[model samples]
Target: MSLRTLAVVGTGLIGTSVALAARRQGVTVYLSDRDESAARTAEDLGAGRAAPPPEPVDLAVVAVPPSLVAPVLAESQARRLALSYTDVASVKSRTEREILATAPDPTRYVGSHPMAGREWSGPRAARAELFRERTWVLTPTRLTSKRAFDRTLDLIALCGAVPRVMGARAHDEAVALTSHAPHLVASLMAARLRDGSAEAAHLAGQGLRDVTRIARGDSRLWSDILESNAAAVAEILTRLQEDLTGVLAALHDLASPGPAVPGGTGPGGGGVVPVPGRHALVDLLDRGIAGVGGLDGAGGGRRGAPGRPEAPAFPVAGGR
Candidate 1:
């Protein structure tokens, strides 16, 4: 069914943002959360009424914890609370399987993820603009109804998010590499600073912030994310480790300039080449720039989506 009355199933940041966005679109929104207080708080923020769906709803958004989304969807479907169900859970494959095992008909069930969020947890940190212009993915199976899928896409557009179409396998694989692996890296790096001296932490600057911004996310929630996507995460991590080993070996060779070929040695053996002096270093830098340019085709502008047309850019001189 098309979206008219929407029931938001958890009043945390994502749910609250959804309510705010949906209301702005002139749709009726009903907010709910197991912690009824959170639902009330979201209502106070003008998200919606702190009540569950009474009559049938056009859309049900399960924005609860990753692990709880399946059970919630199953129950909602059983009780016929909504004509179509979707979730904002980060991981999808596991969630899809659980929903199938627990509730047979996912013809109306769709999986979704908005590639945007803050480290802060509840409604207080919610931003109506959080998902704006950000990529939002929907992993609809063959069983998913076209109406439900299209309405979900409409909801994504309503929230000012960019819509991406992907199957469950592709979606999981892509995020596992881009999102999940980076999070694990952030947490591992942040853990090193947990017990550092106050002086050391104060010495920390934007570089550390850039690296660990995501580490401050809810630990329990991330634990669920990592656990659910363990297989894909492990595969990505293995490739990362191999790259790290190669870099470390290169560093060792640099430190001890022996009879070694000098660049780096390996199977294909791009080999330990020569240590270039100043001019050579500059030449290598240019080569590196070219390499990166090749990876990023055309404008080399990564600030926008790949293959998407960007508005004309006006040149600005440095602060003169």
Candidate 2:
């Protein structure tokens, strides 16, 4: 079914962006948030009205953080807020499990996570085009009704996102590797600068900035995300730790004295010798290059399905 009305339950970046995108598609959107000011701000940005719908909306988009998804969904369901419900939470498995266990009518719900965001968050950072050409994952279990799933698909199309369906556990594992673990790694790398000397800080380059850019994400929100998907994230981090250990050992060997060579720092001997750890270091560097290159080789830039004609706009619905 075409989505005519949407009730966005959180007025943060994703929620506001969903509302803005839907509003652009002639879908009536109602915005709400625990933070009243945020809802008002989203309304000010022309996203939607900062008021509850007089009746149930076609769907309620729960745009809260991962940890809050289940409780917020439960409360929304209790209020009979919408005909169908979906969440934009980063983690899916835990939330889906909770909904199945707790929601009044889990059949009307489908779990979703949009693989889109800005480094800066909140309603002000939201844009209607934030999700354009991005992959939006839908994790519909056996309980999800066809109508609910179709409504969510309509929502995704309205937002110009390409939809891929995956099981909840698979979605969580994918994001743990792609999103959650990377955020933690970035933040950890950025934290190293906290104790650096002024000269060290001044010598910083764009590579460091690029590597640590996601470190600027909201700490509380990230912590919640990490906690919700702890198992999957921990698995990734464990592998990462093993990789780091190898890199660290290689670095230590490289720093240690090798055989003396004419131009080398080793003790003066006429003969040259192989540099310690050079092979390992070169191998690691090559692998890093290949890993990055493989992404492009695999058509990483492709988002949604190319050449899919835009669906006709939703029928304009009257505002309440």
Which candidate leads the pack in TM-score? 2
For residues 265-291, what per-residue lDDT tens digits would candidate 2 score against the true structure?
668665444565666767778877765
Which tens-of-lDDT digit does each residue in 1-320 have in candidate 1? 24788999999989999889888888889998899899999999988888767797888899987789888888888888788889998888888888877774689888999888888999888887778887788998768898778878878988988878788778888778777898998988999997899899779999999899988898888889888888999998997677566556656655675554445444565543456343344455675476434433222122356666663553322212
| TM-score of every candidate relative to the true structure | 0.79, 0.88
Error of 2 at 263 (Å): 8.8
Q: Give the TM-score of candidate 1.
A: 0.79
Q: Model 1 Cα RMSD, Å?
A: 8.0
List residue ranges in candidate 1 displaced over 4 A.
Answer: 195-199, 248-320
lDDT score, candidate 2: 0.87
